[model samples]
Target: MKILNLFFIGLLVSISSLASAQSDAEIEKMIVELHKPTKKISDSIGKLMQETKSKIETEIDSVVKENLKLRSDTLFNAFDDNAINELKQDFVFAKKYPNSLAALKLLRRHVNRFIGMNFYDTYVEVFQNFSPEIRNSEKGKEMAQNLQYFKQSKVGSTAPSFSLVDSNGKTISIDDFKGKQYVLIDFWASWCGPCREELPYIKELYKKYHQQGFEIISVAKDDKQDLWKKAIEKEQIESWRHIFTSEDNKNIIKNYNVNGIPHKVLIDKNGIIIGKWKGSGENNKHDLQQLLKSIFEAE
Candidate 1:
């Protein structure tokens, strides 16, 4: 029922058996009291020793997963705006209580999305401020690499370029739209459910900004052209340009260093990479929405 849901229900990795963090006496007491198994829904099961934090959190997570009961269902539900917001809330807790066993559990569970929140500097700060052991551990080193990539791939980086073909077999490149219109290079595919789910967002952005000099190019990584075209038609993605990506021609993915699908790269009129986002997280949607607002409303 809480945001710790991010690190649990739809997150990753093995849970580390944890003890409770050292909280103020009142908070520690409260945390203990809040989780006790009892006649009242709010009863504390037992006193929390340092080791109790990990066990309690893991137990709670197990209950959550059992309640959800289906991994596919959990993933499907976790990509929308509501889910995104919940994940952000969990990240907030993770940031605020970085040293708390619950926060540590959440961070490791949602490591990919936590790093994906690089748009929000506070999350980065949480990583920077983690305890010496955690911050210097293997996970920490991986996070550091992710942070570096996130920083370099941010808004204002040069948009990478490549040549590909549209639906009609017309060759297309970023150069075509550079200096003329704002372009959104969408990296997606037909078989990707999350990518399909995100088409409406792109359509909405196009409808709002196309008359104001916005254009879009889709790089489809679909091996099956029939399925790809059907999905585009099914989604009514007729207004924008569509390009088919060959296995030997995966520059859109390789050049941008995209690690996931449904990745959106926004470029300004001059072809400067204005913003980029990857993942189905709420913060990712928010970042794109904010970028759209700034672009269309700007002087």
Candidate 2:
């Protein structure tokens, strides 16, 4: 049993590692080897395991084929204008196959794109189309929890509040900025490459807007305090308030729907969220900068 298990595990790993580079026939052969039935097991248990293994292999193959098709899809490649059509198709697939792992994987892969493009309502609809059993699965539970956080960080929702120790050892909360200044709650970490790349641009925004009742509260997700402080000093962004997430304070990440860094939430003086940006893409940077200009320049 041990040798058989190890042989199957090795085959699965080989399939995964070579799937992208393998020809369709070669990939199929590897998948077949991965799920091949063992002669050592009793007939009844072997039959059951074979059925389960066949189902899992089918799911994996379907997902892989769909992904390969997507790689060559020109319309989906264009993305900005044609993404909605593809997303609609994915939603249809999800609804039709409510319990399919392949369907769930497709949804999970595109969720960030959906959220980024302001199609959050459609994303929720897709989630609702899944079966109750699928919805209660572990992955489904995570998606459900994330949906609540997304609602809290929606553009019109009030910013979620939190208190954490700052670089100067002072306790700071989003509530402290309410009625006094517009705030940008930035979720980042010391080790994230994209987060490090955006720090200089953010520093300029802080410097430009600080006098105009603008403030930044950078929430570091670093597990190590020294790394957080070192990154701050290295980036020369010590002027803005800095804090880190800990086992005790990590709920701040969930409270803001921070699926990825560097996630940012912009709030007005009254604490109403004006914008929520994720990732370190050029478009995100431009949008945040343009909105800042509109607010402060108008005043």
Top model by lDDT, which number?
Answer: 2
Q: Write the per-residue lDDT of candidate 2 for residues 1-299, one digit (tens) a residue.
A: 99999999999999875763354344335434532432122344445545544554465578765544334232222433344555566666566666654566567766664334476787798889888977898988877876777778788988888888888999998899888999998889999998998988998999999999999999988878989889999999989899888888888887887767888889999989998887766667888999999999999
Q: In terms of TM-score, how similar is model 2 to the real structure?
A: 0.69
- Predicted candidate 1, C-alpha RMSD: 15.4
Deviating ranges (above 4 Å) for candidate 1: 1-152
lDDT of 2 at 256: 80
Residue 297 alpha-carbon offset, candidate 1, angstroms = 1.8
User: Which sections of candidate 2 miss by over 4 Å?
Assistant: 1-85, 112-117
